[model samples]
Target: MYNDKVMKSALESMMFVWGEPLKVKDAAEVLDADKKVVKDLFLDLQREYAMMGRGIRIREVDGAFQFVTHAENEIFIEKLCTPVKVKKLSQAALEVLAIIAYRQPVTKGEIDSIRGIKSERVIDGLMSKDLVDVAGRSEGVGRPLLYKTTGEFLKKFGFASIKDLPDITEFDDIEEYDEETPHEQLSINFEGDADSEDK
Candidate 1:
């Protein structure tokens, strides 16, 4: 009662509906067929797609299969979508981001000491933008959430890795170039942006 063509069509339908990776056993269970049959049918469809010059292809990752665009078509997709994906960051956010990037797993208190301000809102914004994330909790008092730059930060900044960051020595004289308050030195732009702790 198992028609090969009908089974193949059903497999495609299941994959499309899932909208994510589909495993061989999962597809077979849904179709009430042997796992080997499902895998063979999936392979057949993959070959057919390649031969048909389709923009999308089925790929296996970690023992699961999913539909993904061909690598050659990525540039076109980026051209169509990069602007909306790239959001601008404020100066304060950048400073906080830089500190987290260079000194990962650091607590907000540490950041406050270096930048001389309470960075609650700035850190919130960075988290919302997916540029920074809570790496873990510190062991000391209160077990404060430690923060670090995310992989998305590297991708957005075009850094291959953290080590690709420019040498800190190259920026040695940058501090002396400005005569503003400590807030300005760290480039944090917020109301009460000046040091209020010593106020």
Candidate 2:
């Protein structure tokens, strides 16, 4: 049985330092406690918060655990935490990125048709920011390049995996758009560019 002091310390460390989601096994190893014991402690803490109607609570999402503000206290939490500045995304770029993220393994031509705009610059920006990458080439004529999201994209957006993306129940739901939006697309070249190649 973990002591109250130990459990409180562990929970504080998890909330402060380990800002990202952590697994029970990982937390156990860090706290030097059995996994089951840590889980029990977590459950107790969660229940206590629920009974008290606390503003913060520990949550399990996709098997990873993290501390999050209670739904009712979101506005208060936002006021306490530093406000996150979001970069604006143009309608054209947003449309292009939406199509690419949802219909990955798609080609530039297909993206252009969907958005009715030349996607070269948009794709270039995404590649420059390392958000998107050439997954492969299409089998069709000209062998157009295929694109997909990168690990950096997931990290920047605080997603454990692509599958962790929020459900798109309704296309018109703006609340679903709270997740990361494309700021500046990064470009990455797997093959050495001309400058590196010259060296």
- Residue-level lDDT tens digits of model 1 in 2-88: 788998788778778886568888988888888888888888887887788788766553344556676567567657754443345
For candidate 2, the 10 contiguous residues with the lowest summed lDDT are 190-199
Best model per lDDT: 1
Best by TM-score: 2
- Deviating ranges (above 4 Å) for candidate 1: 1-86, 169-199
Q: Residues 1-199, candidate 2: write the lDDT tens digits.
A: 4586787667767855887666778878877788888777777776777788776666554445566666656556558769766454455655666667667788999988766678999888878877789999999999989998866555445454667554555533433464443222211111111111110
Give the runs in model 2 whose Cα sits over 4 Å from its true position. 1-12, 23-52, 59-63, 77-85, 124-145, 150-199
**lDDT (C-alpha) at residue 97 in model 2:** 62
Clashing pairs in 1: none
Report RMSD (Å) for each prediction in the order shown. 12.6, 11.4
